[model samples]
Each structure stands twice: as C-alpha cells, then as structure tokens.
Target: MAELEAQAPTPERGLAVRGLRLAFGDTVVQHDVSFYVAPASIFVIMGVSGCGKSTLLRHIIDLQRSAVGDISFDGQRLVNAEPARRAALQRRIGVLFQSTALWSSMTVGENVALPMQLHTHMRAGEIRDQVAFKLALVGLAGQEQRMPSELSGGMAKRAGLARAIALDPDYLFLDEPSAGLDPITSQRLDALIMRMRDALGLSVIAVSHELPSIFTIADDSIYLDNQSKTAIAHGNPRHLVEHAEDARVRAFLKREPIDEPARATTNEY
Candidate 1:
C-alpha cells in the first residue's frame, strides 16, 4: 500500500473528482463517482447512450452543479468556488460541445476569434493572427472566410475545434467529438487531438462511446453505468478491455454480450 501510494500521480496539478454525485431535481444521474486526470493526459468518459456521460462532462465544466462532492483543478476548488474565482479558473478551460455549436451567422475565422475578442484585450490584429494560427493548426488554414454552413461535417468539426482552442486553454473538454464523422475523418481528428495534446500540453476530458476514438486517444478512462448510477471502472481503455475483472466492463469494451448481472464496483486497473 505504501509503495502504491508513493507511485501514484499527485492530484495537486491536475483535475480531481472526489465522491461526486449528480442529480436533476429529484432524480439522480450518478453517485460516488471519483477519478483523477493527470496533467497532459487524454482521459475519456465512456458508456452507452443515455448513461449520463455528457451530463458528467457538463458537471466537470461547471455547466451543471454536482449534488455532492467536489471537483478541483490544479488544487483549486471548481465546485462551489466564488464566482470570480470560478470564472478565472474557467478561462483556462475550453469546451467543444457535441454539436460543435459554431455560430451560423459568423464566418469560421470570426468564430475562432470570438473568445479572444470577448475575454482578452488583444488588439484586432493580434486576434486575427491568433485565429489564423489556430485554424491552420486544425488543417483549416486559408479558409477563414468560409461560413459554417459551407463546411463539410468533418470540416465543421475542425472549425469548431479551432474555436475551442482559440484561447490556448490548458484543459480541453470535448463532448462526442466524433459523433457524425466518418471513419477516416474520425481517425484524422484523433491524430490531431494527440498532436495538439503534445504541442499544447493540454489535459483533455472527452465524452465518447465510439470504440475507435476511445481506443485511439484515451490514456485513461472511466466507464459510467446508468443502471448503477455510478462509475464501475477506471483505467487505460486498452487494458480494461482484456484485464477488467468486472464482466460488464469487459463486455462493454469488447462489444460482447453482457449476460452477467450488474454489480456496482469501482475497480481501477
């Protein structure tokens, strides 16, 4: 136990969730959920549809409050933190919703520049340069004037990603990033995600059940079970598929039949 403790990554400089419970009015979504996201790592939240995967992402990014427990970033409290403090912390975080959510009325460049325009005193020239740089990073260079409607599904997703990283945030939150993308496009996006993580040192928390995306990008992951209303597994996705003791976890990862009864157990590999 002492050796294991000594070898564990410290949560001081990363995202940490302790006994988190989420609810909507009288209904509970999840309970006793706990996990740690080490800095510069890609962590995935994965489960079947309607398993509250996206809801958990919402809680992490402060869109919805957890009914119990706490969420912290770099040792600073995010849950129940003062508004000013929370805003300051959130400025270092960027989010890309499942739909991408780019403003249809704006050009791709305008969408990318909006965050800096609203949040920083960077001059127009500076914002423009930053916008170009971000767009180029996402392989959308020289296409800034294009509107969202003109872009293909893959191109639109990339454009949205450019906007998400506009401020060069330390943490990136992505909800269903590959939802409507083709296999090839999804693979390219996965590669881009890894490259950005390496280049920017971002700690990414993504909600995805896409097997290919989850296996390709996740350094670690947590499986949220809707029936149990809690997390049942945590570890590297590749490792969990074969080594997970829980039948449900292995079944989910390997895309096999889950004939075993649902047993609530938070096992970390």
Candidate 2:
C-alpha cells in the first residue's frame, strides 16, 4: 500500500535506508532490505541482473515509492519531507545512468552547465568556469564543444560523469558506469573513479554486474542470491572470492567472463 499520501524525509548528511520493500500490484520486488552508506566511502551493490539493486537505489534517491520502510538522512527522515526540502537535498546528490544520459543535441559543456543553471543563482561566466573545471577533472577539458554523438563510448561516459559531478555533489550514484566500454577504457574509468573519490571525498554508490570492476574499486560490496531470496555475502571482493562459504559464491567466483570476445578460455590461476 502506498499510504494515502507521500511524506518527505527530514535532512541529514549521510543516507540510510531502513527495511525498504517495494512491489508492483502483486509481485514483490524487494523484501526488508536495509543498507547504510557512510560519507566519503564507495558503497557498491554487486549482483547479477534483476536483484532489486536499482529499485533500492531509486528509493535512496527518493525517486521510487517503498511499500514499507523509512529512508533517513543523517538524522532527518526523507520519506516525509516536503518538496522544497527534497529538492534541497537532491541538489547535493548526483546520479549517473548506465547510458550516460547525455542529450544528443547538447554539447558536453552545455550538459554539464545544465545542473548549475537549474540549481544555483551563479552567473553564466561562473557556470562556464565550473563546467570547464569539471570537464578537466574528467579528462575532457577542451572537448566540451563535442556533442554526445561525437564521443567514443568511454569519452561519453566520462562526459556524463563530468555532468554528474559538476554540481559538486556530496554523494554520487553510478549505475553500471563501465557497462559497454572496452577493457582498457573500463580500467581507466575505474582509476578515474578512485581519483574522484580521493579528490572530492565523494560517497559513491555503484551498482554493477562487472566482477572485474567490482574487484578494482570495491571497498565493500553486497551480493544478492535470487535463488535463496536473500543477500548471501557482504564484504571485500578479494576476501569473498577467496573465503566465502556459499556454493553460489564459489560458482560465481569460478565463472569466466563471457561477454568479452577478445580472448579465449584459459586456466583460472
């Protein structure tokens, strides 16, 4: 039940979702799921496709309805907050879609400036400076005049990331950032994410099925098991790959990368 009305949660510094559950009509999507994202740390949700991770993220961003459970900021509850308050909080949060979500018609600089123009009273020159700074930070400084269609897949991802962080958000959410990139580019993006974390002290929430990327950037991760209907493991990827007790975990660890066609099967050393 959506409750007759929607209430916004109060304001806080960090994000916490408590006992969140969602459903569509009769089908349950989530079941009593809860997680806390500490400030300045990368929190990763690593699961195979369709494990309710994206829905959980939507609840965190206050974009989706939770059938039950309350979402809170540092001390305030967001579930019951007013629109103005929600807007205030969301301004400090940035989300990067898997597709990069850049407007095909807009140039990279325009895309980055869009957030500032919408959220702040800064002048055009100030916005331009900010946009340029973000582009430089993402290694796309002079490339702003380029449109989305002009960029390679990796460059587009970085440009979208530039836009996401242009507002100087305290928290960043990336949905499969390295999804369609080449191996080298994907690895480069991973390094860039680490750099951003160190430079800006961003609290990042990344969801991906890419195990290699998970191992590359994950300080901590949670794995969802659809068969058992629960989260089976939540910890460091290296340790989980080495010591997890679940059979599924072992199997997942043993599975080879099937999507990359550049290489053939080799012994798992």
| Candidate number achieving the greatest TM-score relative to the actual structure | 1
lDDT of 2 by residue, 212-243 (tens): 78888988777765545457787877788878
List, in order, the clash count of every candidate structure: 0, 14
* 1-269: candidate 1 lDDT, tens digit per residue: 32333234446799988777778777787888889999999999998777788888888899888647778899887867899999999999999988999999999999999999999999999999999999999999998999999999999989989999998899999999999999999999999999999999999999998999999999999999877889999999999999987778888998887664564663221
Query: Against the true structure, candidate 2 has what lDDT?
Result: 0.79
lDDT of each: 0.88, 0.79
Candidate 1 achieves a global lDDT of 0.88
